[model samples]
Target: MSTVNTTPHTPGPLLRMSDIRKEFPGVRALDRVSLDVAHGSVHALMGENGAGKSTLMKVLSGVHPAGSYTGSVEVDGEPRAFADVAAAERAGIAIIHQELALIPQLSISENVLLGHEETRYGVIDWGATHSRARELLLRIGLDENPALPVSALSIGAQQLVEIAKALAKNVRLLVLDEPTSALNETESERLLELLLDLRDQGVACVLISHKLGEVMRVSDEITILRDGRTVETLTVERDAEGRPSVEEDRVIRGMVGRDLDQRYPEGEGTIGPVRFEVRDWTVDHPTQVGRRVVDGADLDIRTGEVVGLAGLMGAGRTEFAMNLFGRSYGRYVRGSLSRDGEELRVGDVADAIAAGVAYVPEDRKSLGLVLDDDIRHNTTMAALGRISTRGVIDPGLETVEARWMSEHMRVRSHGVDQTVRTLSGGNQQKVVLGKWMFTRPELLILDEPTRGIDVGAKYEIYLIVRRLAAEGACVLLISSELPELLGMCDRVYAMCEGRITGEVAGADADQETLMRLMTRTGEKK
Candidate 1:
């Protein structure tokens, strides 16, 4: 399955940006950046965070008004200036942001037809709006009722809703920003198919994302940006002459301007006695606590081993971890939870942490970090009392510790005083790592540890995991990518429909075997 839109290449340019230069107070966001998009083809713009990609996309979509920067944007060989996003929209450029912009209180149809509402003079034309939304939804393979409130849909569905909204405006150049970050594999596949279909309809697309595999699969051309400058743009084709094909080295060389000998640094670790265990652990479905979502899952982690949990979406991996961590899920959980070879009660988060267990949840916004709070506050969340004295938070002490974490973790930010929401997803993930690292637990659980982080930062996190393992901390990682689990874990527990179906030695495991076990026959998931 591919996540890219494909097309027959024509010898004509659809969109072009020449000598683009923009500056912030302390950062030159883009310098002499030039790019071209062919008609009916997907052009992927790639770079590490703070590499001027976001700035370029904003400029292209007219979020940065004309005359604010020195740049020339031309479409179809004609010079045009976009004064605002509305002007760009009128020019058939529609952008979808990573964080969706639909209103929760509004229906899908309402959100889709928000600014361009169908109206007759002073009267709102609800009938026409609903009809148009229905048509767009059908085109995007969404059969869900368009009248349903957007809040009730999953993140993936809401993303499709965003696409449907964009489709309503008759866009020619569609800019998608990390569109698949929150989607499951199947949902992502479906979305990619939709993009391909759109390209067939003669719509050009510019995808700004960190996922290189997907970028290689769908894009005809890929451009790399680093430190606010345009690097080489690689053309991808089965018959391309004298160039790298689907290998990561060429892309890495362009993105970082350096060769990484090793993506993940290795460290020696000695396995000690079992530190955590769950016996006959079953989670009654969260909605129905007595019904099992995870049934009789038995797994163990040693003192210095990294164990990976791998499965498809809705396979109960996250649910099992949540139930194991703090009994946070399931109305009725019946199981034996143990730590350090001794029975431990984890009725709440406090009890779990007190017993030397820490979990970094997958959904950073809902379960991991508090977005409204600052970095210092989030880092001190799991173990606030340790940094506090006499029940009052010592602000100076907290800052010192947080500062150390920021430096060690290489969190890219001016200071811990900055709001966590303002930071990128990768940085927010680092803050989550700092929170768990500060807890100083024996067993640390990381779910989708490198979900949206760039290549450079992913290597850093991999090294961090290696360091933690070397220091005798048992880490549990849940990830959708099989290669990550195979590369990082010492052992792996494969799950399918709330059961620990298979186990493999990390050294002996392959993606095919793990997937077969995960997709077991006769399992009603």
Candidate 2:
């Protein structure tokens, strides 16, 4: 175990991590990584998906414990060691992970003070709990009632509750990991504003995000990490009017080790006759009676064409996709799905797979892959029959198929036997894509495919999508980013309130034009 010298307090950065080294059984996750976060500033960490950002943060937050890694942590220029998460919290450090830690069934107040509840005579003090939670909520500009269950709030609101939970410990140095990956545009903007407010209050924030525009907007300094080491930390240059002047390409160079001349790859495929079509697709909400989740949505994808679905969070894009695939989401009310001009019946997931249709879900962690399983099992899961004989599996064939998929998908891993849960977010996503692609579908629907991955990984996925289209497959891409839609799709369809509002060629579409159609509730102008 390494030790830090007992240094006296002095004026310096609020937090400093020097020469952090973390290792797993087969990998050195971090190597000599260092970071310094000044007080009253937003320091952004930018990197590729497996670039050791999260590992370094875990060491600092005591999730890895003091003796588990070789590092020296300093607060107020005084060397200190954190034994565990609680010890780090007591030192005014709080971490809000990308996947929120709030309990959905509990009330906001209960979740905020979960471990350190207020007590009166050895009993939980309900009044003090709600009072303190309300104060913290107010500080973050959240106006919701603290007594409401966390499940009743939107994802954006739940994110605010997570911040409130951190504030309950009187956090001075806050760390947020990919905070806006799941949020809509409006929700993401509000959260960015809150971070700026926190900076104004002299709170030191370490923000880990892949959105370059968002980082440039709120970050005072940016640190770039690549392949388990620090590339460099550049101070964000500002113009005379107090606007960020740093080029996004510089950050990209640092992350990927070279300039990314183009973010989305160009496709050479030409569109043909309609290969997949859906008409009058109406689906009712499963839990709510007399309410339609997808209302008479109609669309068609031509062969070798990449189509985009643009909408807000609740526009039923995912529901429509899920229902079309296998009626997996909402209750199917009425719809007609056809392939090659022949009407098809997709009663369940198996039937959908047999009908040459595949869907990659939006929430990959819960609905896509089995985390505990190894890469080989997950890769061949959707198409096990191919590698089996007489209902008996062939281990050699399975290994061969899994290895091919991993190589084709560019999945970074130790081997096919590596557990899927231990891989990084980008690699796990590759496995999910590989599992679906192994089924060899004609019409592939990708929902939020690049939601939380880094730019380098995103570019790789985009190239894969183009390759699939070039191989004469029809693709329906659902994403919240309008730029992504414009960059990749041949045509775009806008959905509003469960209905298809408008359509435009991708070359002719812009953010404003799509936003107008996405918010439309009446006849299109």
Candidate 3:
């Protein structure tokens, strides 16, 4: 018998998606999209708002079943079609969405073992559940007790619990969608480290994030998608000098399909007289008696000036802003607020709006926009009077104003009739800004405005902020990113332990200086 030459078999990619095309009525959301993730490696998906990143992930996760979209998902070189989320989980694939799904009232063990609880005779075995939950928690570096309610934990801890839930399902291919969008700097770093550890343990990871810095730091390979199509997949490349690096400009060009020379829009404007002033602002905890959250904060902003509030997580920035706006949060709020040299009492939300103050909250989905409502309604919700006759809304006028806002904000959508929940995070943020702009406020307070948005969208928002300031609006911007504050604000106030520690001119501000002042407590101007 003649011995035939046999070639050695090579394993295929751990997961491969090819020729994905999804369509809705009058919209082709994804066009021939494709992806390949290697085993034990981190794959990053990059895209702008409404660029079909989430839609593609949904397809992979079986939120849209096999028949709903045209694509081929192969694992271990074998074609697999998932019928639903359960089917996907059966295939060792798990996805953690941006908005957490844990029930606040449930304990950590209960949430982790939900739907997959250990049972004896169809009765849930509480001891077994707690034991497994504890093991999973310890495996993920979470030291908290599993019996504690999820509500008692911080947002960062909640995210770790979410990961533990994924691990509980024995997930081999894990997808994290904007995992750190709501986390502070330290929390985000810790989360990224956990992902890296998971990767080293032979688990594949798919990370979807808008924070370019984090993406660059963690991704082994990056695939940029634009206009619902894959532009290019880039790997870490080295120059002739043999130093490993990836140029941010190269990634930006792939994401936007062009060169973006500037990351922030020009904020050149004339600063006029003081438009708003707050003196001795102090606020006690809403439920805790005699506990102060904001203490003796004195600040002032001029017309057409962008002021930045800088602090670490739990530095009491959000508490101060919420307490100042209509006293919507906290009790025993003692503050003197003035506009144009006239003292105003913001006793309620209605009074705050009437006094020319508008706030765009940080948690836009839950706190800012009505997700289930249509864009037209959300756009004009704040200033219904502008589009209403008497107390009744004029449908035609509402449509006109909504259309105007949609065009002005460049909101990418099927139409104004589309529900806000269906829009991307960036577009939803635009809707919130439009709603507040219609209020015609002389002072605008934006909290963590660009928290989860892409770089391109951030640039657009920066332009809008500058435009508002040029129109003589005093803009108070609160953000955790020091670069954002340095780039956009004319002046920055540092907060530490619920008090204003110090203030720095934007031109003279740096990260080290701001951090020093931010940690300096009990120092007041």
Which is the leading candidate under lDDT? Answer: 2
Cα distance off (Å), candidate 3, residue 486 = 0.2
Query: For candidate 1, what is the total of clashing residue pairs?
Result: 1
Identify the candidate with maximal TM-score.
2
For model 1, residues 1-525, the per-residue Cα lDDT tens digits are 112333344366888899999986555779999999999888899887778887888898889989888989987777878999988988778899887899999999999989887898877898888887888888888888878999999888899899888877877889999999989888888878888788877888898878877787778789899978999888887545534365777888788778888776765889888888889888878675356678888889988899999888878898888878888766535888787768998888889899888898888877898899999999998898978898999999999999999888889887888888867777888899999999898888998988877887788888888889889998999999898888888999888888888899998999998998898733532
Query: Which has the better TM-score: candidate 1, or candidate 2?
Result: 2
lDDT of candidate 2 over 1-525, digit per residue (tens): 011112233578989999988888888889899999988789999899999998888888888899899979998887878899998999888888989998999999999899878999999999998998888888888998999999999999999999889878878888999999989888899999989888887777999999999999999999999999999999997888867878899899999998889999999888899998989999999999988888998899999999999999899999999999899988999989999889998999999999999999999999999999999999999888999999999999999999999999999888999999989899999999999999999999999999999999999999999999999999999999889999999999999989999999988999999999999985432
Q: Write the per-residue lDDT of candidate 3 for residues 314-370, one digit (tens) a residue.
A: 788999888788888888467899998899989988989999999999999999998
Model 2: how far is 317 from its true place, Å? 0.3
Ranked by TM-score from best down, the candidates are 2, 3, 1
Clash-forming residue pairs, model 3:
none
What's the TM-score of each model vs. the native?
0.91, 0.96, 0.95
Could you tell me the TM-score of candidate 3? 0.95
In candidate 1, which residue pairs get closer than 3 Å at backbone N, Cα or C atoms, i.e. clash?
A: 289-331
Worst 10 residues of 2 by lDDT: 1-10
